[model samples]
Target chain A: MMLAQDTREPFFRPEWVSRNADRIVEQLIEHAYLTSIAVGVGSLIAIPVGVYAYRHRRAYVPVTWLAGFLYTIPSLALFAFLTTYTGLTTLTAEIGLVSYTLLILIRNVVAGLEGVPRDTREAARAMGYTPRQLLWRVELPLAFPVIMAGIRVATVTIIGLVTVTSLIGKGGLGKFILQGIQRFFSTPIVVGAVLSVLLAILADVLLLGLQRALTPWARSRPRPEGAR
Target chain B: MSVVSEALAWLSDPVNWSGTAGIPNRVFEHVRISTVTVLAAAMIAVPVGLLIGHTGKGRFVVVTLSNVGRAIPSFAILGLALPVAIKLNLGLGFWPTFIALFALAIPPILTNTYVGVAGVDPDLVEAARGMGMADREILRRLEVRLAAPVIMVGLRTASVEVVATATLAALVAGGGLGRFIIDGFAVRDDARILGGAILVAALAICTELFMGGVEKLARPRTSTA
Candidate 1:
């Protein structure tokens, strides 16, 4: 039960922030570090699988469904399950985080590849482009926007999930949240929550910018008036 | 005991299935919370999404709101909700968890519904208008029928997400299968953690399968035209 006298400290005290700036920066860096590694490793696994699945029509549904099923498992459960085998290590957290990103990454990669027009493929072939050459020079460039969009979504989602990693004692900003909850201290909870949200939004905007830079052709095309 | 064997032993124990902290009761609480949250979210999101999509107005707002909602972490929302619950003397567990999960479920539903309705072929809508079909009638008979598959996909995604995240409710002192994992962590009991995780994973898989079936049923094979 909570105290009736409202004895809780204010969520954002200047003195606390000044004193804990180093710890705050450390947690922020740790949060970004974990998220980036998970997303990086997830994309490494997902991209080749996505490419193969896209090429093989028969394998697409089964592969995606499996990924989707994996995604359905709760993050906490996955973390706990992994901890049983891996113990309370970063490996457990990374495995759980990476699994969650696969579905989003694969689906987006496939969708991006599929969005390439038949005429474009035919034209590339007519120009004597091999499969590898076409994939590199034509298909991939066109698929950039969609693939980037997927990465953006996956990155943001993973950022959120990393907070749950604190449960396993590997959580960056999440440690503060857990600590706050255990002690009923509003300051750490508020700071952690705010920082996590800020990181998500910041990552999203950065990815959006990257998408625009990569897909310059998408922006160059003038839209028909009132089409939107 | 080996981790796997110990986990199985814990799961097989009949005593774990018949108390206030029993598996069955926890499962019930999880499902009930998820259902209520999803239903409440649908009620709020679907109608507003339909209005925006059908009228072709506020598309930017809907899209922006969905993006913002998605960007906000569920854990952060739960943390944010806790203080409010405590200050109001509304208890620390159920309501906070429920509200946070409810927030989590809304974005997918709202965005999907908006996209589905908005993506309905303009030709079909024009034809209905040409035939003097009322706007409401066109929305019901044509737009919604065609959009059924997308709406169902949204519902399926939201339901699965809510059910999975509801496990976090136990962290807030709410009742659910998460209790096992939380308690196990507190006590350094690997078997209990594994047992709880197994239950959560199983429940999530079942929810996905059930929602997948409903999504298939909602898919329309032939056009009403």
Candidate 2:
């Protein structure tokens, strides 16, 4: 009996797995919420800045490069800077996270707006489409795919960065990963890494779908045709 | 009054000279660590990347592995390594930090090298072969030269990354600029905090300027190069 106990033959640990399974779902929910909220909020702000700068047709490079400079700030330092004032709240985290997304999304949106074929913009103007009408009707739909790609990259990056937020007592899968490291526990670390990868893969596939749906025009022609 | 004088005193001390003072030595040491890590990672990763680019197999492996490495983040890798290294009774300070920096520098160099080499024109490669250039000669004459800028771009980014990332070595109890930054923060000293940050910014800018000059010289002098 002592030998059996010491050897620990039962490897499944069904009891432990079942107990934390609810936590896995809860953590996943929290993580998804954190990223979507940041990306969504960031996009709302960036799209307008992008549109404004594109219309001005100047200051685009400098404004966007300035944004890129801010984007390159280390994630830990960024979060720490926010929490210093806001005191470890979700709001600070959101602000810090959302601001980072702006740089990437704004750059993409500007690129997308500029990428709209010159002929199309000229045609819209020739047909007496107002700036507003052209933007709403002609520019936005074509630009959506590239903007969404930026969001995809931003979302994935923020999800990984969310781990640093655990230092602020924000519980999520990051807490699991951090705690696992602190305790030197393999199972929890493995579980967190696997779940995080799964989250990334899931996000990638979802964004792929969204990208295709938004840019149906891209798929409509189906370049290179089938057989390689 | 004495404490205040001492505080300003350290900042103004003209005796603090590069190659002469401990302060400058520390800064150079950090730069040395960063350069060595990037160069080492590049040496291995670039060759592997070129091989992969030329053969065009196992890109899936290269991409997936790099992504996986990136996903873990550098701090976590250091955290994981510290205990294992300690348990093995291995040297902890510089060696451990080097390993972590090496890991962090690999992805960009590998991926960019592969991309730069692969982006070379297949027609040029074929023509060289048709002209009876040996495979080795063709690679030396064409592939490495064509790949230089992309590889340089990768190296540039990687070098900047290591400079930024080397700060985390302080977490492993190895001394670097992060020592000042983290300590300054711990004590709520804005002077030190901002001072350390300023130093890092200065280092990054200087490194970029120097490397830009170096890259200008290193260009292989082809039309495509």
Candidate 3:
């Protein structure tokens, strides 16, 4: 009944990281790849649904209800459930991750569009802008900040969830964690956990930068006095 | 279709309803763990959020904590907590799962509480003060009542999240319906895996619906906004 791990093995091993450097990088790449696919596909689906919801008003309730229902399912359960059909593949991971982004993204999209001032829309219409032109030329730009905020949240969330996919054997850095736990080894677990957190933070900062760059007007928008 | 029927059969079996490893016990374990984690998170977050919202101090810290909090993955938290728990001789199972889900539960409650209170009309607060009410009395009678809906939204969000992530407790050798999923994976039993997933999802959805009902109940009859 000898344990494979020495009793006093250090929690972090620099040498182990050095040995597994290539695979670690590969996993990191896979993690980023999975996150991007989910968020990208999610946005594609959510934007139109959000716009429709906003335009119809009546449709918002059921749309949100459906998204909320999907969002409520825990990631582990969704991933496991998907396994019954999709098996252990990247597709299964992507489906679970994308389903999550719908609620966050759709809500944000609708909110952003709604935040466009009524006066602004009226003014655009008065200036001879068609409905389609007004939406593209004025409303979308005004809505960009709120929409970008949603994207940032969704991206960060999807990145974290990508790690959970490892439980289904598709998680990028998550595989290290699963392995580390099974073997009673601490180094890989630390590596996987730290890298994933760092990745999340990095993605957040990058998305924030993108939002700022895209919505320069948001920075100059006048805030009411004393508004935090 | 047969897979689903098989899973249904697995779920309906009376054998799955008895003993320590039974479905009922597993569900109770899940609910118990989630309940404790959410309550603990609310206790810490509500007071802090209320103070911040009421006094308008430490606003930056709360915002930053919540922003960072949302970015950390639950699994990563579980992985990181493992060593700390081991070092403290906390052993495994509940402690590690509790640590992770508790952390997951805090940000939503804290942020919602702060926003709800701060958004309370300043004129109302001024009128309360002008009527000779003390700050504590205004917070209790006016602010808390006004902010109840938002606070409940936070509670709902935290409850749903904790319940969902509580499934990961199984990954750490912790008890919960998640154990069935993990065990099903080990045995390559598709029926058990699907059945476990259905149970976990049902519980999470129920939490959401129940919380949504509570939130609606908390809404002020005369809408202030």
Best candidate, DockQ: 1
RMSD of each: 3.2, 5.8, 2.9
Model 2 pairs whose backbones collide: none
* DockQ-based CAPRI category assigned to the predicted complex of candidate 3: medium
List the candidates' TM-scores in order: 0.90, 0.81, 0.91
Candidate 1 residue-wise lDDT at B137 = 95
In terms of lDDT, the poorest run of 10 residues in model 3 chain A is A1-10
Off by over 4 Å in 1: A1-14, A119-130, A214-228, B126-142, B220-225
Estimate, for each residue in B39-90, the C-alpha lDDT of model 2 and write its tens digit.
8998899989998988898899789867776566454555555445544546
Candidate lDDT values, in order: 0.87, 0.71, 0.89
The native-contact fraction of candidate 2 is 0.04
Model 3: residue B35 alpha-carbon error in angstroms:
0.8
Better of 1 and 2 by TM-score: 1
Give DockQ per model, in order.
0.60, 0.19, 0.59
- Local lDDT at B68 for model 2: 79
**Residue-level lDDT tens digits of model 2 in A1-228:** 001112222212446557899988898789788888989999999999999888887878787877766565555555554555575688877887888788889988998897888888999999999989999999988788888888888887777766656655563567665655455443454555556667867887899898897777889876465521
Displacement of the residue B49 alpha carbon in candidate 2, Å:
1.2
Measured over the true interface residues after superposition, the C-alpha RMSD of each candidate is 1.9, 6.1, 1.8
Q: Residue pairs in steric clash, candidate 3?
A: A165-A171, A166-A171
